[model samples]
Target: MDEVEVVVAHSERATLRVGDVFLKVDTDQARIDVEVEVMTLAPVPTPEVLWRKPPVLALAAVPGTTLGSLGGPSTGSPAAWAAAGATIRKLHDAPLPPLRGRSGRSIAALTAELDDECELLVTNGLLPADLVTRNRQIAETALRPWTPAFTHGDLQIAHVFVEGDEVTGIIDWSEAGQGDALSDLATFTLGHEEHLDDVLAGYGTDVDLDVIHAWWSLRSLLAIRWLNEHGFDPFAPGCEVDVLRSRM
Candidate 1:
């Protein structure tokens, strides 16, 4: 029997890899439903659904490794990064899914949440007050009105795979929804400023650099607390903390 490798485990969900199959166990069935539904609707390559039972959804592992990860040295050549960007552009251009669930959580609601999180980050000494304040200022632009697009809400670098210069698959669709397209780009390129140009090379020339920058601040600020409580270190070098400080 093949050994089961733990892919990711957190309070909300856990994913296990046994040989070529990945078993996802989520606490909320709705999240699993969303993942499955979006995976079916998304135009990009996704893991094949093997089976699903309640909170456990099984999928065949996609070929190729991830593009790279935050806080780590980037892998693959500029071409590979551009390929990933092209893949993102394809997803963004695809027909919008019905659920506006994760990404477009409403500007007013997100603004309120960002303010609350900033206050907590400062009050609890979770982050330096100056750091929080500066990021909050930078994050303001992300709150402004913007056109919507089909988005992979948590389009982290690790979620995208590339073999050579070909993007093989994109995983993790629980957060997929209609939202500001910049947020997707921001999430993918967060902590990877040097690669932004490379990504945009394939993504497009019409992108708003400022909004993407704002999203970098907004996403990093919003993630610190949750990441800390989840036993993850947001302050790790090249991680969320560094991402926030880079904006200052």
Candidate 2:
């Protein structure tokens, strides 16, 4: 019998892997619906959905290792990162998923969310005041409107799977929808800033470096609180906090 490996376990959800099958257990059935819909609509590779029963979503595991993990060195080659970028480009160019939940958030809402999160960071002393302030200021650049694209909301390195130089699959589509393209880029390169250029290269388009940098600041700031609350330290060495400090 194959051992059930706990892939990820948290307050909101948990995923277990048994051999080639992954069992995703979550409270939000709506999110599972979105994942199924997005995987069907997306023009890129995704895990094959074997079945779903409310809280349990069974998916066949993609045949490759994760591109990388947060705060860890990426074993994926530059070419693999580039391939992942190309895959993202393909998704962005595809028709938007036809779902109300896939609609991008309004700028006002995003601004308010950012403001609230920033206050929490400062109040908790989770990060230095100056660092928080500067990054918050820099993050303002990303608050503007963007032409929505089919975006993989959480395109972290870990969610990207690759076989050799080819991207085999992208997982975790609960956040997929029409949104700012750079948000996906920023999330993909979050703690792995050094790979940004390689990704952009394969994305095969020019991008605003300033906005991308701003998103780096914005994303890291917003995520620290959630990470901490989830029992992960954002301030650990070479982690999200280090990524923020690198800006200064």
- Find the candidate with the highest lDDT and give its number: 1
Model 1 alpha-carbon drift over 4 Å, by segment: none
> What's the CA RMSD for each of the models?
0.8, 1.4
> CA shift at 18, candidate 1, in angstroms?
0.8
The whole-model C-alpha lDDT of candidate 2 against the native structure comes to 0.88
Tens digit per residue, CA lDDT, model 2, 1-248 = 99999999999999999999999999999899899999999988899999988899999999888777888878788898899889999998998777533226888988899899999999998887899998999999999988889998888888999999998999999988888888888888888888888999899767888898998898888889999999888988767888789888
> Which tens-of-lDDT digit does each residue in 165-213 have in candidate 1?
9999999999998888999999999988899999999999999899899
RMSD of 1: 0.8
Superposed Cα deviation of residue 2, candidate 2 (Å): 0.9
- Judged by TM-score, which candidate is best? 1
List per-prediction Cα lDDT, in the order shown. 0.92, 0.88
Query: Global lDDT for candidate 1?
Result: 0.92
Supply the TM-score for candidate 2: 0.96
